[model samples]
Target: MIDEPEPRRQTPQELRGLVGSANIPTLLMVIYQVTRDERWLRPPYLPTRSKGLGDHDSGGLPEPVQEEIRAAGVRALLDLQDGRAPAIALPDPEQTRRMLEACVGEPVDRSYGEMFAREFRRRAGADDGPARPVRGGSDLRVLVIGAGVSGIIAAHRLERMGVSYLVVDKHDAPGGNWLDNRYPGAGVDTPSHLYSFSFAPRDWTQHFELRGELERYFADTFDRIGARPRTRFGTEVVRAEFDEGRQLWDVELRDSDGLRESISVNAIVSAVGILNRPFVPALPGLELFGGPSFHSSEWNDDLDVTGKRVAVIGSGASAMQIVPAIAPSVRGLTVFQRTPPWVAPFEKFQQPIDPGARYLLRTFPLYRTWYWLKLYWQFGDKVLDALRKDPDWPHPERAVNARNDGHREFFTQYIRDELAGREDLFGKVVPDYPPFGKRILLDNGWYRALCRPNVELVNEAVTSVVEGGVVSSSGAVHEADVLVWATGFTASRFVSSLEIIGRDGQSLREAWDDDDARAYLGVTVPGFPNLFLLGGPNSFPGSGSFMHFMEVQMRYVGRLLTCMFDLDIRAIDVRKDVFDEYAELVDRTSATTVWTHPGTDTFFRNSRGRLVFVSPFRNVEYWTRAQSAGLEDYEIVAAP
Candidate 1:
């Protein structure tokens, strides 16, 4: 008898999931490296003495390069939202390329092109075959702009559905926020395990993941789903026009090579998230500061800060992470705070996943699914009730209303308990805003860093950046050798920097006008029929993993593709009435949540003082709403 195929022997590392190609593993390594998570394999991915993001120039640029840098910085100081400054001149492009090559090793080539082409032919709707008639005039056409998480997810879903789609990204790759924000402590606030796709659960070694790991996750996502072939790297969507006459979208793309190309598609999806653009605060004498300074999102990686005295502005999530991560290394750290933040107690924020749990998750995907589900409800949906305004509860300043008041007391006690002995810091750390009013920051050594002897948390708002340091409005000048602005991205305004035009010569900026950024089910717009949006307004989840929400939107887009196939519709635009109705529902729901609490300031609200980005409903409600599209929700156009 032929010997039965020998049972596959799994490596020890494989069994432990220490080695893998998934996103979470890399994320685990990153968190472990940065935070020294004892549970993970010791010594995470560490680069030998390199420039961190927001590093200032150390007088090493040529005259021309230096001039360009000065010009960009001056322009940014003048107008925060004008455009992204060009990357500072590197140590010669070829030399930098060589260094990168040495670091990552020789590039590995994969045949995604052939894979995508084959899958397209095999799964393309009914008209895939040579004899099949072109019922809708073209075979499986889709357009996706923005190469961030949402963009990647949309492309993956389209690929899975065998749709012929082009994904355009201004950046070199995916991972939106991850790609853009590369500050010293740049990492995910959520646990890496829960912050990933349901279809691609990873054996992450730690809870919070760092930037490199997140980027790898995006790379692995394309590798897993075979979506790379349909992507145009280093290409930006300058204009997207809706052609009502042909039921198509005309997209004008510009690449790094300076080549301009216009393509037509039956549908368009804007995957560019609101957080892609950096928002630097405007302050007097900001340009006059001769020392190093830059936004947290657009981190400069050449200026060294090993022994420099640092001044960090904006005590938000990024600020919190930046302060703690750089505290141990910097000579002195001065953190500027506009308002104290409510510190929620999360024990696992800086910890690693248990070994037993890792085994179950990696070996059995069901366990992972169950864990994600538990997180979905525990973190995502459950908070909706907690955020509801509690009319009966006491304590107004600590918490605005009742349900909000209850949550505040619960979190305040948690913080009080954590800082039991340190009353001095407790007074400074405890936030006046109700819990969930702003983005609740996880404890990634922020509290512990505050207790450090070298770190100082300043509660005063900054008024100006002098030559030596920053002067607060309270007339205190804190001297520093280097300044780091951990202020976050320009949120609430969708695709503000990019110049995009839809049908009838309508610009996206004109349509949004910095406020009223709404879309149909946070995916489609009425006038821009063929255009779909991924992480558009009202789609951002207030709790849980943003990836979970992205997956839901991806699945929804996939279903739409299925409809395009089954119904043979060339295009479908959300009805204006339907979009308006959805926007009204979103507004009504948001008004009742803690997000609208009068006492707090957050990026979730627009200039009009209206909450435009976050979802007020529970995760299940959103999932159900996005699971399938109603015919009445959209106006479909059929081919003649």
Candidate 2:
């Protein structure tokens, strides 16, 4: 027998090479969650300061010290798993409240502690018991439109509760926007770990995954949960009518061959997310263009743009991603901008996850959960204070208040540094409005792309599309062989394509005339009985990952369905007064945010100048509100 090899000793740099620099705090947090030792929560190991605040310095600890701390933490984990160290008790209600408060640097409502504990158990795999099917759910059925994230989630929860349901998607597969959008550099801006479902943790290969990876995640999730057989692909819901007498919904569907069929169900869930519909701007002579023209969402891979001149219109999130991707290959690129977006600098925006980190996420216990929690605290409400409009602030043009001004200065400096030598593009790239006035975009070498010699950034308004190219308001025409429309969706038009008739033959569109959309907690409406909306109006969070909001909404909807079946209720409509009260609160809260400021004009607002696309509450607030089904808020009718 040969002598045993010496145990490998890893240095701080070596460990970081395995994990990432941004994941150091996450590793320590995993140890803290497992051991509940306060020693793991001290400085140099865990972050003592919050992000977005001026005090968020890294302290620049010595590399050797960091190595020692990580080594000890690793040893502790091993000992705990090997039964050498005792497992600590879970945090009590009060302790959880204080912990969340400290983690977020804000006072959290006590109700969130319960939510936190439930989530903790679920992520820890301690709560994987089979769902106790509702007693009366066998007789009920649901029709979920669109097999996207929201639709998949709705189906999963419904099936777990033993409810009979069917999912219909227009695409050939389960991924919704993910399936439809195959544009270049299509991916998520949120961190990959936090962007995923809490129950289904994935070992993402990139810090911010691309479109293919995200699409695969959804498809795999669908297959794993056995939702594939229950879903009808290439099927679209054309219309749905509520039969008041029978208390059921008659839904019309169209297949790929244009054949129509109708089915009756007890309830309906509209999950055709807000971004499904592509909005191509109505420019003169658009139909007369001879070149290949399409929206960014409707990307055509067949047409090769290897060396052809390409014209890209719009400078929003999608355009930001597209410009940097296609700039290198195109013979020349012309980008038209209406308003410059504030691009925040994130070093890991384009970096892939380390193999060692992926191994830890897949192999280690509680590592992914701890990593999610760290991201939640860092990105959750850290910048919420900056979005609030300071009533007495004098400078409204530059920023809303002193704190907002500070953020503007920081972001501006980042832009300045990124474009240091290219001073000509500075004024053209920076926005004049306050931060969060529009959706914040992550930088993916956008400025660098704009500085390329083959790329041209035009700030003029596009008048129309001519025979060979686009005409600007300055009487100049830019020629191109390909034209791309990155103009975003008509988000205010909720369920516009579907003709949903509610009680007494009232159309949903007629009720919300002029696109003034409103709903009760973004799930139910007053006249729409036995109907629910997923990714509905004002349901999107102003901050944090949108997947978190969808999970909360689906859970709440599941509880409502369970309660209805258990109570023998045929129809449940939200009280008119209750809907009014909630809508008023939403309006009041939205008025105080930067989204409604004078100088801002964003897609978040509707035609009537109301903030209908995004919710005004923090992530915690929404989670607390959607934690339970408020039976008292509805008018329940007994089954006929």
Candidate 3:
């Protein structure tokens, strides 16, 4: 006898556990969406920091009122999950814009709202439809190089579109930079929620997760998407030559066994990201160092440094993370700084997520989406204005303008607060350049690390690596048992290691002579037909989650490929005029930003002092441009 299933229990604890205070605003917004209730749009439920957009302000609400709202939200969530509530229509473009503006505490344009709505719908499993096969596009064979974030995203989209593809990487597995950079304190500075793929959300335990968790996330993402089976590990693409007659790319690959092979594919997606290569400066007597020396990217974990003297070179992002991590353990730690970086304050930079927050993210419907969007607003384009040059302001060197000067003051004050009573460290740590002129680092106890008794902050350039340790420009040799070069990558040299020959046998190196790498929308080039770059020149978002940029670029690439298949086109190249125009626009926009300021010398700029690494446009602007493949922007050639 089949017994009727017992009614599922719904208790207050279960409901309360499903939502957190951080997500209260979002839950209310969703309730408003479903019920059209004006009550959900008011005080305690709504954001309260800056006219209902910034941080959550629950202090104004009585405890009883907050509880009532939570109870209502849980009931709504349960109803929605149990199919008791009718499905609500996706937010209209205007509603989406206003909602995001209210959530972000900043004015957002229509394009941003539309982008957010599309992403929201997609994440909610309410997007247009699942990817269906195109009737005429079965002959496409694409090769994606690198199994990093960009490569994984590109592969996932290609599979969704029902296109045949293969991914190859030099590493044994996925997680490009995460896999390589396993130094003492290697982790992402970006918030974990916002740093991940929008489609594949996880309940992150930390605000800024470490290397292992990130690597696991990437591996899990690759496995979940069934991308691992399509990837060839320990296989590196050495060169790719476009066969103009056949309209295919002949890719040369070398496997782990030192065996070379060639594969012909209809198109190529170069996702070997900017940060793969390690750049160790040619310091005098570098090879003469008698102790163990290594770049932070190529970390030697087996070497023990406890109670040993360790010299860390470069005070960039990596150094900022490493010094704090190793200072307590090492007997003596000397940090060599070429220049001080502008570190922004973050309260939870090193804190883990509360259990209640994790519970809300895991159990509640649309809670993670709302949280991500809120973070996107807070960290995304909000800082863009400060990066732009104010023509009316007189001080361009110390700061870009009054707003940028305010930022400088704020950051300086934070530093002063962190290093209170230690005026000696103040002169050594404060940067002279404008805020956002360089990559802004999150202060993960970096100031506190400097104040440690065992740690010494040397603000002098390293002249050479002596027999025992690093020799500063002041002619003082700082001895150490280990030397860690935290210097960054050759970011401007996009895919420079690979020999890629395009139309008329012109190599990519020759096309980008003197490291003048430029691409249309940072994806397509004039001579490189049917070849797309994932994280190419000018693709780095100046101030936002780079993962968002990757997703946008991948979608654009996917759209381009789908268009090619639909039109029966074999190869597509950006028009030279279009490429030149876009390059000029990029250069012009860059000239008006702080990255191009004369006082700044960062990896963001190329050898010619051009802003080659970072994008000058807003995230929403890039999203709008990358949402579609403009057929007129390229010259499509039919297959022979």
Whole-model Cα lDDT per candidate? 0.65, 0.79, 0.81
Please, what are the lDDT tens digits per residue for candidate 1 over residues 263-315?
88877777878876667779888987878888887668776778889998888
Ranking by TM-score: 3, 2, 1
TM-score of each: 0.77, 0.93, 0.94
Q: After superposition, how far is residue 129 of candidate 3 from its true place, in Å?
A: 6.9
Of candidate 1, the 10-residue stretch with the lowest lDDT total is: 47-56
Per-residue C-alpha lDDT of model 2 across residues 44-158, encoded as one tens digit per residue: 4544455442212232345665665566556655654454533544555565555555444456667557766666666666773248899788888899898888988888888
Worst 10 residues of 2 by lDDT: 51-60
What is the descending lDDT order? Answer: 3, 2, 1
Q: How many times do residue backbones clash in model 1?
A: 7
Candidate 2, residue 632: how far the Cα is off, in Å: 1.0
Residue-level error in angstroms, candidate 2, position 188: 0.5
Q: Supply candidate 1's per-residue lDDT for 549.
A: 83
